[model samples]
Every structure is written in C-alpha cells, then in structure tokens.
Target chain A: MPVYNARIIVTLRSSILDPEGTAIEHALHELTYTSCTNVRVGKYITMNVEAESEENAREILDQACRKLLANQVMEDYSYTLEETEREPA
Target chain B: MPVYNARIIVTLRSSILDPEGTAIEHALHELTYTSCTNVRVGKYITMNVEAESEENAREILDQACRKLLANQVMEDYSYTLEETEREPA
Candidate 1:
C-alpha cells in the first residue's frame, strides 16, 4: 500500500474570539514586537496514512479532518496531501 | 507602511510524547479511519505585522515565535512571511 502524508491546518473562524491569540499578541507587545497584530491561533496536524491511491488518501484525510481533527462549527480546516514511498523494514 | 502576513507552525519534538495526538489517533481508529497513523498535533498561528520591509517583518516574526509563540524546550517552530499591501481604511 502507498503511504500519504497529510498536513492539516485548522483555524478559528473570524467571528470567533480567540483568547489565546489575544494573549500571545499582548505578550508580543510586552516583548516589544509591537508590530504584530490580528494574531489568530489554531491547530496543525500531520498524519501518515496508507491508501490505494492519492484520491483515496485525500478522501480519508478529509474525513479525518472533518470528523475528529477539527470542530467544524468554530474552526475551518484545510489540508495538503502528498504520496510517499513506504520505508524499508 | 507595508503589512506582512506570517504563518507560524509549531510542533512537538519527535522525542516528546504528544498526548493530544495520541487521543486524536485513538478517536480516528474508533471512527474506523484505520489507515491513519503517526498523527501529530501542533499550533498554527497567523499574524499580520506592520514593517518597513520584508526583512524587518521576518525578523520580527522570528523573534515572536522564539520568545512568545513557542516553548523552545519541547517544541520546534517554523514560519513563512509574505508582504501585503496595507488595507484601506
């Protein structure tokens, strides 16, 4: 079976308040990184999957993101998938 | 002044055990997404910055990541920076 590497980025919806982001932005200002603004914090997920084809891998990853990796109501998720050779055992 | 958009990705060092990742992986298996493996979870941060030049923006973003956005002991961070035109009032 071919292996696929998928990187998923899940970000808070703009309308949602991101307290983590706000605190980080405040810390940045305290550190004198005053230029930083509009900071939003989210999740980054990387997964390796075994599948028959690239399309199959994408479908699996999409489902994973939609079901468990991200909360669809408050966050939006996007992903990139690439095929890789299986490592020699 | 030019605005720059920076995306920062922070992930746990492979040596570190990611409990969140493990939990998500278990959830995936329970959901019957059996092909998924080696799931790692991290932080995704997007920031808008005001800088005179791209180099300045990159410097500021790097400082933000190293000092405030990521804990250097157990996590590793990387970022991408792009210059964008200022939004009109």
Candidate 2:
C-alpha cells in the first residue's frame, strides 16, 4: 500500500464574520503590529492515509474533507496530497 | 511602501495531546475513511502587512505570530511571506 500525506486548509467564507479573527486583529494592534490587516484564521489539518493509488488517496481525502474535516455550509477547504514513505517502527 | 501576504500554520507540539485531532480521526473512521490515520489539526492564519521592506514585513509577521497567532508553549508555527499586488478599489 502507498502512503500519502494530505494537508488541508479550511477557512470561513468571506461573507461570514469571524470573531476569532477580529479578536486576533485587535490583539495585534495592541501589540503594536499595526501594519497587519485583514487577519483571518482557519483550520489546518494534516493526515496520512494508506491507499492503493494516488487517485484513490485523493478521493479518500476529498471525501474526508467534505464529510468530516470541513463544514461545507460556511467553510471552504483546499488540500494538497503527496506520497510519503512509511515510517519505521 | 511594500505590501506582503503571510500564511501561518500553527500546530500543537507532539508532546501535547490533541483532542480535536482524535475526534476528527474517529469521525473519519465512522465515515468509512478507515485508512486515514494520524490526523492532526491546527490553525491557519492569513494576514496582509504593509512595510518598508521584505525583512520588515517578516519581522512584523513574526511578532504577530508570537504575540497573537500561536501559544508558544504548546504550539509550533511556521510561515511563508510573499508580495501580493494591492487589491483594487
């Protein structure tokens, strides 16, 4: 079986207000990082999967992202998948 | 002034337990993505910074990550910075 590593980024839709983001922006200003703006926060997920092929890996990850990793209603997600060698025990 | 965009990824240290990650992994299994394992979740932050130079931009972002974006004791963070064209009005 081929092992694949997938990195997924899930972010809120632009129209939705992000309270966490707002709080971080305020904290940054208080810390004198005034040059920073439009700060948005999201989720980063890294997972490893054992699959038969690259396409199979992608399909599995896409399904995972849609079904569990992200909320499709208010969040958007993108991911990158790459093959990796299995780790030695 | 130059403007730079930074993407920051902050992940919990391996020594720390990630309940979110465990929950996600269980969800995937229930959803039949049984091959997927070692799922970890973290934070993804995007911000724009206006600065005098590339180094200045990096310094500001580094400070932002340290002071606001991540908890240094339990999380580790890394970022990439790129120059982006200003958004049109």
Best by lDDT: 1
What lDDT does each candidate get? Answer: 0.91, 0.90
What is the Cα-based TM-score of model 2? 0.95
**CA RMSD per model (angstroms):** 1.1, 1.4
Model 1 lDDT per residue over B30-86, tens place = 999989999999999999999999998888888887888788999999998888879
Q: Worst ten-residue run, lDDT, model 1 chain A?
A: A61-70
lDDT of 1 by residue, A14-85 (tens): 999999999989989999888999999999999899999999998888888888877899989999988888
Off by over 4 Å in 1: none
The candidate that achieves the highest DockQ relative to the unseen native structure: 1
TM-score of chain B of 2: 0.93
**Each predicted complex: what DockQ?**
0.93, 0.92
Query: What is the fnat value (0 to 1) for candidate 2?
Result: 0.97
The prediction achieving the highest TM-score against the true structure is: 1
